[model samples]
Target: MTQIDIKVASSEILEKYFIGNELPLEAPVETWINYEREEKGMDVKMKSFCHLLFYSKLGSQLFDSINLDLDGSCCLIGTTILTAVRIAVDPLTEVVYSENPDRNFLKSNNFSYGIVVVGELPYSESVGDSTNLTIAEPGYDTITNVCEYVKCVVIIMSGRPVVIEPYLPKMEALVAAWLPGTEGQGVSDVLFGDYGFTGKLARTWFKTVDQLPMNVGDPHYDPLFPFGYGLTTIPIERKATQ
Candidate 1:
């Protein structure tokens, strides 16, 4: 059995073909950049703060590394030019370290289980709301990995709908526990099946970033979960004997 080499960087792969070659005279710089970005799935906007800080940094590095190999005669024109590009190649040992034990436990037990989401979902930290909020990579990894074992009922404790399209099909159930401020007892109660949760989606939950400007009046009206969509728990309404 041959082990596939995952340690190689994209730049390294490209360099093997074009490192010593001169840039094509007739090749359009903007067209090349656009084509590369599309092929690599890196469509980060230059002016966006979150993208500039996170996704763009690595993408810019990859592009710059390739750009340096181009002939000096080739004119590179873009919104931003990367001064320095850093590349590090390392073999991935473990994708999700913390979830390993849990996965093994689930495998050993082979029983139905539920997932209680405790992270702060797409919510504003300060005076204004933010856009294009997706679950972090680690969180996505954990959820998707866990889902592989068996069906899962996810309870998300966020103030708004999160981008769960890619992972949505894996999840059997979803609960949007929007900021139940101060009182966590209710949230706990719902998780333990002590209380029935009935919360509706106030806004649209987008499926992908391409489906942006997702509002009530948008021309492209497609969401993973539409507005006002809510899942109802089993009718187990019970009151304490007072």
Candidate 2:
């Protein structure tokens, strides 16, 4: 989350000075790029203000929970999750509960209300096109159709750009929605708004472990989707319908 904080601050700097500041940065996701410290595991260079807004909302939730507990009954929790914002996340855990008939199977389809049992803390876009992704899955030809349905092209590799040479004709815009952390809502926010998608896969999505990119200290440790790519959303006119 702190990484996001830095990105937020840097974005402010980017905004106040870059692109004349008077006008919104044009195609920011691609115009500007900043990848957070890899160790932190978050691309702090947020392409949209929506991410900033979401983090602010999280802060409000934290303050209310703690301020209302002013009875001194609550002690600030400091652990893996340093802040309530960190705790109240959308973690997708793939755990199977102990055998119990009460539950039909291992997991249920309902979402979890995210628990913030105890924690403290604080916290806290673009567009483009270019698709025609390739897919080499022989039997999964339908994936090609799926790509076309969504107007995807230039299939970004989840794992080594899936030898799409044979199926490139089916795509329009392809990207690797990396295994980002819990706050996936941030991902959705960027994808659906004024900001363009600028994220790339942090890790290689390999079909087999043997094909995984090795960290051999080579300068060209290439990724399927080379670090920066984004697009701007098309402006739309609102019309009242009868």
Candidate 3:
């Protein structure tokens, strides 16, 4: 039954939180800024982002004020810090907003369902025809958050061999998503629990790069994280009591 106290700010950071806004919003900008300035010590030139955050909280509270049965699922944690971190640390949301929604406004169109990919599968250095270890351009081989909001992890490794034993404890899943040409969406379909995570790591991962020239397939190569080794998911469970 308690109301959530709202703080205000001014920044372009709205893009930093929610995405898919193209047409001018109905909320009066000056009214929000003035009220925020007088009561919350808000920045004078209130930015669109601050405006968006303020309105978002205000909108949520307004619904709760009407006693719309907001109990567990609707309760957002307090503080600007939490909001900032959620919008920052989440890879999925970043990917969604990065889709240039303003240009390709999803709302204005007919489709309602949305999807965002936030993880990256590791890819070996790509090769031209020669495969002579020539320098390569950053190919379109990685997952780019293209308008759908989803928190994702990506593995980006340079050509140098790695000693991955220590860091494996912190990781949830691994995918040797070797460098595929222009199939980000297709690969993402597989990794994001979409097409079923069924790819195999193409090479071997040794605890130490020293294991190189020690292939298991042919007298010496081994991998610490063999291909097709990572998966991530959100756990759906009953909320703990306050």
Q: In candidate 3, where is summed lDDT lowest over 10 consecutive residues? A: 60-69
Assess the local accuracy of residue 117 in candidate 1 as a C-alpha lDDT between 0 and 100: 55
TM-score of 3: 0.31
lDDT tens digits, residues 18-77, model 3?
343422323422212212122245333222222222344223211111111122123222
Q: Which sections of candidate 2 miss by over 4 Å?
A: 1-139, 148-165, 200-242
Per-model root-mean-square deviation over C-alphas = 18.8, 18.7, 19.6
Q: Each candidate's lDDT (Cα)?
A: 0.48, 0.31, 0.34
How displaced is residue 190 in candidate 1, in Å? 3.2
Please provide the root mean square deviation of candidate 2 (C-alpha atoms, Å). Answer: 18.7
**Every model's TM-score:** 0.48, 0.26, 0.31
Question: Model 1: how far is 229 from its true place, Å?
Answer: 1.2
Query: If the candidates were sorted by their TM-score against the true structure, best first, what order would they fall in?
Result: 1, 3, 2
Q: Which stretches of candidate 3 lie over 4 Å from their true place?
A: 1-152, 156-163, 217-223, 226-242
Q: Give the range where candidate 2 is weakest over 10 consecutive residues by summed lDDT.
A: 114-123
Shift in Å, residue 40, candidate 3: 60
